[model samples]
Target: MAWEQVQKALKDHLGDSIYNLWIDPLECVSYRADEVRLACPDRFYRAHLDRNHLATVQQIVTELSGNDCKVILCDKETAILPAAQPKGQLRLPHIPERKSVVRALHPRYTFDAFMLGESNLLAQSACKSMINGDDTVGSCLYINSSTGLGKSHLTHAVAHALLADSPQTRLRYVTAQQFASEMVRSIQSRSMDTFKSVYHDHCDFLLVEDIHSLQGKKKTQEEMNELLDALIKSGKRVILTANNAPRDLKGIDNEFRSRMGAGLVTTIQAPDLATRYRIVEHKAVQSGLNLEEDVISYISQQIQGDVRRIESALLSLSAKATLAGGAVEMDMVRDVVAEIVGLSTNLTTTLIGEIISREFNVSYKDLQSRSRKKVISFPRQVAMYLGRKHTEESLGEIGKVFNRNHATVLHAVKVVSELCRCDTSVRRQMEILDRKMAEM
Candidate 1:
């Protein structure tokens, strides 16, 4: 009975193709005197419905009711549906089942939780469209932002939304290193076929965190290329996050770069003072701490780093106050992060070694104990390379950490440099490691 008159109007006016595609799928939600809320499953559907057929929809309603009536797409949100396919029906598709790298989904990344400021509207719509499965939008979604822009949260939100609606949807969220590590293990185990099947053929969607890590590794580039092409060809969606654009992913394949650029690209710009305050207040509320607006404003104004540090300062103040059984006042924030503002310090020797060990097979002990073997030295060279990249320490000081002269440190940098140009595997490893260190 809801759209009875409207239906008659539509039948009288629009042809069948436009009717079926545009109006057929819309579901009516609650309505008020001012608005008749209609919603399509995804934004693409909404855009299509609105673009080609809004006039017809409006005309139908106006004629049927003898007054103006309108339609609006429901929120671009998909409800998680039960995923149990009939026996033998939706059995896990033959995609690769690499060990999932989604350590945890952010509780705040859902549509209900995200602060819907105007800045992120386009991206939100794109995410909603991709989640809704219109297929017009390219599968490769690029979220560009500097540190602390909540890119990861948005990425996770898309992953959660899609898999929620279609539980049978094959989804894996991972950092680039984890992707490489899984691939490396697959190659080692001679189950590259399974890896290939799981990662490329079987995956319905892949949300890769920090794809800039793919910049250098030729092997990772090729492996990623094959996986991307497979997914792209099969109509699977991929979401990628990075600190910079595809062009900035040094050493990445031009073809892959071209493909990434083909999709929707959006950036999370640095938050304004108001946004930063909102972030502070949000973090403070989670900790059951409250600060005065003036104080929140001051703390937000003082900080210039990513969202990570802003939250950290909030937590630090809360912890300090909690230990003293006090409040997270502005004075407390000021006292805690005073030194953290506009200050960049050298990467400590220990942190540098751990980064090296994680990147290369070299042990932390080997980093300082003078290992010249290819395996050990390769990691050591990586450590030196990162040191040059991320610290105030001079090359001579870095040499001291490695028990080598400055010239040797320079050589290590050069050696990795030359290897990165030709060896895809080596390049991928270094890039991932470098990003890891930078994030830390």
Candidate 2:
């Protein structure tokens, strides 16, 4: 069978999500009798497929070609680095090269519009400095946090602020997925020169969101690495957002991850209960609806983590009230809460430990172990606090999960509570971790 047929067969066997995130980035560069060579964009992709999917690929190749075939996977040669293009007037091909436009900025996501709580105060300040011409913050700033935490909002606000100050400032904002798709298209069209020219020559400031989404696309990863190097070398500003920290990112190249970490790295924590209440009220006013205090309080308690979910609940209640021809009361709010909160499954302490561990880059074993090290001890305290807050587990029950006495759990809970009141950073960390556990 033809290589195209094999490709189609594999894509059909694996679903779109798996294929696109993993297999679609591969290029079958050469083939011989019973042996096929696949060129991947980077070493990480080659290792990933070799470990997880190569056996299945071999099976598919055998079924397709009616013979046992050997699959050799390796990184694509860097010799295709666009120096071969003849120096002269450019020629337009019959088919146009693919391109993606940056997503439009949300008008509501201005700096003044963003609600400032302790959770996002630092991030907000950093972003303001960037807008105010503080180039000392380094050319690359990485902002990472769980979903609905305001990374996107901050980036959008930065764009608006920059443009407001100087409309002629050239900026481009795209999700990591868009950049990866464009990279794939450029490879297909053999027009990488055009891709490099667009990013290096056109963008004065570039912001990419959800960069964690570019996990398995090594070519796109390499392309982004190059783009970042060029932009930073030329003193152009670049900002990137992801769900997790650079050190926690799996399947990304080490050199690229180091570059991401070399600059300022900041996280947006989940909002605390009071902050959630404020958010509901803020969003309520923005939606032009008046919500009762009791109703807002009820939502503040029920919707655990995601501000987006809180906004969604408010929208639903507002819509329902409009349809029912009545004000939003506690009963209506309870109904909305049930509808929204019921969708989330109950969380487990084991899961909570995992999320906190990943967020702090502490090992799960260390978290549960009896270690008095400040780093491990504090995360353990936060875990204990989260356990009491998010789960139905009693203090003694939670103690069993952490291999401690009930009094120990209680002490941990107290310490974290006090720290939350005193340390803004600790408070924000708990807020973000609690939501991630509850949402998970």
Candidate 3:
């Protein structure tokens, strides 16, 4: 039988925990009716298999291959660095040694601390179920969102939750860049086996952050593919976070992409206004800054669609208030926002929509509504086009304001751009809108 099939049967036979710790790391080197050779990463793995699981593994191989195949062990060449050093030495030069196995779990990123919103409700719920030990949630999950949308925060929360739930549960949380860097280091030191053992054998729950970082790295993607396959076959839990959906990742390996997609995929969308307000409030409270409702609302309005920026703004405001020895007020908040985000005025999609609606003699609600009437549609399209041109909001953000999709926003921009190029009247009107917005 194929190693993949053998891997599945072994998981069924040995169960998840046992198979993951012992048998999962073993790579089939060569197999025949009379003999089979398995590759182990290090002396420890070979010794463990030899002392405990050799007989069981041999029997399973015999049953699967339909012949009594002698299981022989071969240890792969190993060294974590360029040269073998003492046992307690650090392997990589740049990376500092940490006492904990799962590094990068921030102290503040706990489940209770995360502000639940419509954007991240389902993703948070799924993470919570896994944390609460719900087997129905499955062993693999993919959390995808753009930058500043709290993908990293949620993954760290998962780590904290798992550790809290079971103190002894083995886990390793690393970014895709870290994983890829380690793989490159392993290749340089000829310790690929040790790398495999570290991830596939030592880890029970692997939470890899920023997996989109592996998109263009060919060798790293291959290594990750193998590691993922081994972990999945052994029934180990793997949580991956990325900036984009699996299929949307450009230049990633096809097989690796498929493996990434073979799990529950959930996205954290951009938070709505109310959600942003809650986030600002939560972050302010965490920072020990008592923000008034108006300040919170102002911060939320200014730092829309990005939780990180909201927290940053709150932190800056808190620091400025502390320095001034006074309470935070609207002017102070405005100055801090200007310093942090470089704002000229309160320019937002809503303001842009209002301006365009008034100019075209249409209600702002009608412009934001689902009305496809030419009178309302032209102004709405103009609003979308100008929103994209003037603001830092994403196409999705502009679409949300106009009740349309990014594709629709792009179409609007294209249509408006063509109109500006061909028609002098439309060009002058667009110039007027631009000047008015700049003045605002």
Candidate 4:
């Protein structure tokens, strides 16, 4: 009861985001007159709370209890120790058991390494909720996204977190193709009972990637549907990833689609400009390349979708810089961008205007017109801003394309730049436009 009061106070004081991210995961093991004990998920979690939040927690507990209350923080494993035991006698932490994953997970795909952004925040948060064993997220989670947008990364992170927190957790991570192949092999060998038992009885957590691949396989779909029903009924956790939402998946039966969509379904869109910038910076640092801010900006702008492309471009730049025995420069970045993005070196103001017109649904004539309405002028400003960034055209030349003066072009650029900083909606629009142009 006292812990509930402390939780309320902490939520009110720290706000929902911070409280949910840091405090909500902690479990209150016991509360006595003079002492309160809380169990953290792991050592890393306990250490972070001890360093940053323990004092506040102690203060809050003391105030809530109307007495001097000592707050003890321990890992979940040690939470069962008797309160009379000395701190020195606490059990030593053990290494987390390695998970038996079907496919090897990338070493760097853990939660700490995933970049957070407006686009992928919900997907990441849902995955975290699953990891924390928060019941509110349901027993299943479906993540759908285009390639290279971090679905696999989040799934791998979930596996890492689940195994770390609960070593004996039966986690089976595999692609849909792998699942189907195993089923076929079992059928041929007359071991179908064993196959079904492994997924339905032995598994505690099931992670199947690219379920879209099972679109037309009727038997696999039926088997998967039955497996999902079994897992969900038994309260097992399931995470499924695909390139399309369940409703949009073709050749999948209504029953199977319904099962996939039964839980929280979240989509990860292309990262916005700010997210891409952070991704570029983080990857560059990991590669030990000292890229100038301008070079980073250029890469982030030129490469829009598919974070893997960013990594590839960085690798190419690093290799080129090493061969030349010099630091990375804008020219090297441009060549890499040109090679990977297939962007023509001759991007013109006219092409930029056309792309903006298509994106905003404003006619090219309206964009170049004297209209001052928000709809028309807003798109015009965005075009001018993009023109300056993507093209080597001078302000005067860009202005002529929009039927405006150099001063007007400069003002438009300034306004759009400020909007990109202060307005998320505008920043998202810019990112979409940037991706569209890059795809061209």
Query: Which candidate leads the pack in TM-score?
Result: 4
Top-down lDDT ranking: 4, 3, 2, 1
Model 2 agreement with the true structure over 94-193: per-residue lDDT tens digits: 3222222347888898888787865788888888876665876777889989999899899999988877784545677789987887667656745455
Regions of model 1 farther than 4 Å from truth = 1-101, 342-440
Ranking by TM-score: 4, 3, 2, 1
- The TM-score between candidate 4 and the true structure equals 0.61
Cα-based lDDT for every prediction: 0.69, 0.76, 0.78, 0.83
Ranking 1 against 3 by lDDT, winner: 3
Q: Write the per-residue lDDT of candidate 1 for residues 210-275, one digit (tens) a residue.
A: 888877788987888778877877888888888898877788889888877778888777664445
- Compared with the true structure, the alpha-carbon lDDT of candidate 3 equals 0.78
Q: Which ten residues in a row have the lowest lDDT in candidate 2?
A: 93-102
Evaluated against the true structure, the overall lDDT of model 1 is 0.69
All candidates' TM-scores? 0.54, 0.58, 0.59, 0.61
Decide which is better by lDDT, 2 or 3.
3
Deviation (Å) of 376 in candidate 4? 17
* The best candidate in terms of lDDT: 4
* 3 or 4, greater by TM-score: 4
* Residue-level lDDT tens digits of model 3 in 62-103: 544434569888786632222343386444644322212566
